[model samples]
Target: MVLAMRHGAHLIWVGLLLCCMVDMGATMEFTGAEGQWARFPMWNACCESEMSFNMKTKSSHGLLVYFDDEGFCDFLELLIHNGKLSLRFSIFCAEPATVLTNTAVNDSQWHAVTIWRNFKNTTLMVDNEVKWVEVKSKRRDMTVFSHLFLGGIPPELRSVALRLTSAVVKDHVPFTGWITDIKVNNTESALLNSAGVINDLCGAAANMCLNGGVCNVINDEPTCDCSQTDYQGKDCSEGKISGFSFGPLSVLLTISNSSPLTKQQHDMIIYRFPSFQAVLVVQQFTENADILFL
Candidate 1:
């Protein structure tokens, strides 16, 4: 009877682990690479609609969202420029209206972005800050025939002028960051097709950085800097190290582990320990792991 109860408990633990892993796959990571993009079903913002999403990045410039009518009539674009959010849209091809936010969102922190459109009047809100803009064109409604594009536009449509009504968007940099919890008109679920985007967690949440370590985005990748903390590792969850001495020659420290170090982590270690020729550390959880120093 005791053995059967233990087996049942183990099965329950495994089931919970699998559930947690699936939940972590909701967030999407945009590589910011050229032509990297995600497409969603056409957004019906003709007269009145609302769109909201959570985003985090360290890029000063990148196209966050774009949609249009194949270069014929109307379009809308939300982009990050100079660490600020800018919204531009056109109706009936008249002079495009622009609404720029004073709040900077390129600080590598998660921000809630909301866009509310009611005919000619539009409201853009980032967290608590809000801005408004109104179109001057006679037509109040926006015509968007193309599928909504996030992160960037399709590579094939770059050269096609007619396909992309907004010429400036074609030249805009692609977004490299994390976007999740996207909703249209308060609806949370939507069919999303993506390219060059990872549908997994990459330090998207503040909790990803353990031991009070701060998370920063560099080159579109999330990295944890453990300089201030005693722990030294990618997420700052490893055992603490005390002291180090610089010898006449370089030193190599290797630990047998599981996961390999990321490029950013590797560079960080090199910069922190310049005297050491190289540090090869394999990250894993083992009681009898071997550490070699040469």
Candidate 2:
């Protein structure tokens, strides 16, 4: 009886791993934007500083995630339509998308804002809660890697595009010690079975445009800013092979929240598309590849 139970445990673990496998993500990974943002508020102690979201292109797309002493999220819009971020998994957050005032953690301690994505939803987990439920969302689309905004928007949206600079010191407030860490992960996934896996990916890859162009990501072989209209879409993988590369074939793209692939991500990509031609395209990329890939 003991041996049978142990075997069963192993299968369950394997099953969990399998669910993550179906979530092979196509992302532009970035890292070490981790750690602390320098204690400089934008401009002055109390000023509306512009922190531009250097997107897939130089032009603005829309707002996604914002951090610093004050925080706001433009990505939580999906819950209205999808019902939940995921039916297979649950996430928790102490100081979540409540407000930029940093009350989500409740203890005033260091907290993490985990934005989780699955076939059905975009769940924000503060720390880790077991009984977590869906929260109101504003994200229009969900992708493997998304464009994020820090600081605040420039007056470009207004007339003060120049004032939308990064956080700087102001009055007596100093904008100091406002510890904030913003990171995203594909993290966990839920697969009902093989059939559900495929169904999920199609829906997962199936464009929400939920938050509108306000928030978007790099999945489905996405691409942006095509010259002369040769290519377009989230991953640049959508165009015809007609213009299939006789040129220099060099493109410079940025990847954010990146890391070495777990065995699962690697294998899933291969299983899904044998023609991936995987290579080490600079393991530590430093750009947000998903904002609005139109």
Candidate 3:
């Protein structure tokens, strides 16, 4: 049939190029001198598989968001405003999340940022597609984790790295980004990998989420009175893990020799073998005897 319809259209174009080669894995790596800058805290983070950055702002340029008392902070900002590429994705620790963009941000080269999740929703990818998402209701503790911090912000005294070639001007390597293949796709639902994480505060490490109630320290960034349901934010670190229910013969076997028979000698061995005794009596005496030799 015409060579089987050209080999079934070349096997459906090689199965759509292997479903666009799904690869979301990068475990963090950065190299910045002349004023060093590197910060990543999305709880258990190990992202950075691709990176790129270069700045020459004539104006508008600030990403020092610190909400020690407002909301759980989702105030995304990536500007170049008026000229374009002015993005915004805020939540005020409220409903349905927000996102405002100015578009066109390919500047000089390499650009990829992906923070996908499951168990519900939580997406933010620029290159692999999706650029905004956060539809949470009663789930924020499934814990795949998300509390990323890079090249600045969330720093009280220092750390979060960022000195930037002391304002580079040589051949211009400025912020030559490199953050590769970071992945977190909860198969499509694990509450979208629960956006969460929390690290030693009071001592100060910051980065905890949960907007609705409790988790307050209002003035130093930790304000989340989101109305509680038993989950605030930043502490879903892989969700502490929990799951179990097995029985197909649930074996633990190991009581080979036990003795303690009194009370009329255990009712004369259960009335002298009452058809292989199965008289259940737990607590108040605790006794179980099984002896079969047919």
Candidate 4:
């Protein structure tokens, strides 16, 4: 009985170590440099399909993911444009459908991104905020002949007229950030087929965060928390803003005072800012009633 108990405890320890290893190996950081990319097997987004991933970045513009039929028939692209996540896709050579999120994800924080497609309808979710659009194309299925490209595309496929069908896809900058646990159809995991991609944001010898910023290992990647630091930005190297940090309260007040929010708009903001933990007491005086935040 004693021997059996000891063996059981040993097995549990081994299982825990394996789980940690799997977690550490899951994240991949993109350098955002030219010719830096990862290629995964093509995602069959024809008809009903889904793709989801976690991403962290500070770049305002970069191509997060792209796949299509050698740029000929149909294509889909997820990118960061103007600090917001944008999803663009086309079916049967029709005008592409674009769904862009209002909440920005380029704040160097881990954000869950999901894309769901059903026939012509496509939905994009960033954290709890959601936006969707329907394609006007007559065809329902999207044909993709190329492998799914993440971070960027191969330099050889850069030509717009000859190679890629979508001209706009080539113009977006390459992604420079960390992406992990990419799932297609909610089952298949995307594995990187490229070299030079770092497994962790901060490797053994170097710390990416600067200016006394706290470096935390989240999802096996080094993340800089600039909240308590004098400096801000992705690596905590940027100059600090000259004001009190009121957290989400200040943002809510600014938006409430700027214009009247529709129910849909108010709901979206509420999803993004679910709590006002920083402020002691907060009130919003609108035409209808006063909403308190605490």
Tell me, by TM-score, which candidate is best: 1
What TM-score fits each model?
A: 0.60, 0.22, 0.19, 0.60
* Predicted structure 4: clash tally: 1
- List model 2 lDDT by residue over 103-178, tens digit each: 2332324333444444223334444532223333343222211123222222232243233222221110111111
Residue 280, candidate 1: C-alpha displacement in angstroms: 53
Q: Rate the local accuracy (lDDT) of all candidates.
A: 0.78, 0.27, 0.32, 0.74
List, residue by residue over 1-25, the lDDT tens digit for candidate 4: 9999999999999999978744853
Worst 10-residue lDDT window, candidate 1: 266-275
What lDDT does candidate 2 reach at residue 86?
18
Off by over 4 Å in 4: 1-25, 200-294
For model 2, what is the alpha-carbon lDDT of residue 260?
43
- Score residue 292 of candidate 4 by CA lDDT: 47
User: Which window of ten consecutive residues has the lowest lDDT sum in model 4?
Assistant: 250-259
Root-mean-square deviation (CA) per prediction: 16.3, 21.6, 22.4, 20.3
**Per-residue alpha-carbon lDDT of candidate 3 for residues 1-294, written as tens digits (9 for 90 to 100):** 999999999999998876563332322222333322233323321221212222322223323111111123333333333322333333333443434443334353445444433323334445445554454545442221233333232222233123211111122221223333333333211111111222122115233432223333333344443333333234422111122344553312222222345566532222233445444433232356433221
Residue ranges of candidate 3 with Cα displaced over 4 Å: 1-4, 7-13, 23-85, 88-294
Model 4: pairs clashing at backbone N, Cα or C within 3 Å: 71-165
The candidate with the higher lDDT, 1 or 2, is 1
